[model samples]
Target: MNVHFKYEKNIQIEHLETLYNDVQWYAYTQDLAVLQTAITQSLDVLTAWDGEELVGLVRVVGDGLTILYIQDILILNAYQNQGIATQLMQQILEKYHHIRQKVLLTEEAADVRHFYEKNGFTSCDQGSLVAFAQVR
Candidate 1:
């Protein structure tokens, strides 16, 4: 696929819109400006591209020491199951391996759970950890 990864904060909004839309992340795509700001303000951002096409992205917000939260990880539908997501996660994981706590919240789909589990993430409720959230 000639894919390459780049750690960039100022990614093109149009490219991100296309990538997010390709993955059905309608809510984010609904506001291009907000999405662009979110990307620019994240603690870290990783993008995967196939030549000129944006195919995957990983967004993280962390203190760089004590905690790291994986805010988003997505791969375009056309590029799913191609190890792109894994590579993106691996890069992020390696970068913050020393962080005391890593966390994320995601939809309760088996595939989603399995994807995180396979990447060495255990569910909070599955263990002694508990999580609470109030989404607006």
Candidate 2:
């Protein structure tokens, strides 16, 4: 199977809508406008494709210097467990490693924690505590 990676300028909003809607851990139902705004504001985004189909994607949101946040790493259900997500992340790290900026986040699952660790992210007990308001 051949995998191609592309840094996209204008992702088909429908593709993102489909991926986000199908992802249980992500909350994309609030409003389409909000989702559109968030996607528009992302600093950089990488998408992986198997021919014409989008198989995986990851986005980086930050100031482009000093700090970066990795978000929305997703691989379609049909394509999971085939190292597609890992490859997507590897490409992100390769592009950003030289900056040596601190990347920070809280993952939703232990399996995801392990995956992040494998990608050189360390668990930090000293990281800030985050609280969120209840979403309706």
Question: Best by TM-score, which number?
Answer: 1
| Candidate 1 residue lDDT tens string, 1-136 | 8999999889888899898888888999999999999999999999999998889999999788899999999998999999999999999999889997999999999999999999999999789989999998
Q: Model 2: clashing residue pairs? A: none
TM-score, predicted candidate 2 vs. hidden true structure: 0.81
Instruction: Return model 2's CA RMSD, one decimal.
Output: 3.1
* lDDT, candidate 2, 26-108, per-residue tens: 56645766776776689888998888777778888887776778867888787888998899889988888766664656656
**RMSD in order of candidates:** 0.8, 3.1
- What lDDT score belongs to each candidate, Candidate 1 first? 0.93, 0.76
Q: List the residue pairs that clash in candidate 1.
A: none
lDDT of 1: 0.93
- Scored by lDDT, the top model is 1
| Candidate 2 segments exceeding 4 Å error | 126-136
- Candidate 1, after superposition: displacement of residue 74 in Å? 0.6
Lowest summed lDDT across 10 adjacent residues in model 1 is found at: 16-25
